[model samples]
Target: EYWWWSLFIVLAGIVLAVVDTLTGTMGMFGDSGLLGGLFELGVIVPSLALGVRRLHDINRTGWWLLLVFGFFPIAAIGGGILLVSFFLLDNFLILTVLGFAMVIGGGILGLIGIIVLIVWAIKQGDTGPNKYGPDPRMATSQ
Candidate 1:
């Protein structure tokens, strides 16, 4: 598929992220913070769409994109929350075990999700037509 476009989109996201960071550091973007949010949204939307489309090219559903990026953050956050709960609660063994379990489970899922995305990102597109549709590479060449 359009690997180049995917690469470009990733780079654009990074560049935009850096710009947003700089803007936040300098406090120059705006007062409402809408611009900064827009900058963030700019990256999120394109990255998700690109990932999903690329997955489609490889005969995978767009949901895989959500699975990859979405699961990690959710897991990490859940882990963090559990970790915080461990500290706040008066109980020791029970809370600690539960908290650590959530944290570890979330971490593992996060890692797996990352690995899946990486595999998807680097792996070549389908050789010919796939469940998603006709091969973009083939169509373009023809």
Candidate 2:
């Protein structure tokens, strides 16, 4: 159930984003466009709630979602900083090496975290609940 919901939400968001991009509207909400912004605004809370619930279903804390989502942004920001450093500190071989290491390492770790989250999302919830509340499956069964 959680997997299905997550998949649906992702697909819907993708569709909206694609539509927004293709339309090329000078939307008040910037590049996302009107529909995209509205869709994002409407779904953000529910999506986060669903993500948290899905994590809970796997006997994990909601904070795992933050870790999972944080990876990509942190990686991108680190990469951007490295790109700037490459320009400003061209003479420093060590900075370039460290920058490459951080970008690559962060990207790899982010990909691993995403894969782990997907695996957890597909797995069955803990039977009779280990933590975070009663088993959603059992709750529905009764």
Worst 10 residues of 1 by lDDT: 25-34
In order, the Cα lDDT scores of the candidates are 0.68, 0.77
lDDT of 2 by residue, 32-51 (tens): 67777887799788878988
lDDT of 1 by residue, 27-102 (tens): 4444324355565556677667777878887788988766655655655666666666666765466656665676
Candidate 2 accuracy as lDDT: 0.77
Clashes of 2: 0
Q: Clashes in candidate 1: how many?
A: 0
User: What are the C-alpha RMSDs, in order, of all predicted structures?
Assistant: 4.5, 3.3
- Candidate 1 accuracy as TM-score: 0.67
Model 2 ranges off by over 4 Å: 26-34, 140-142
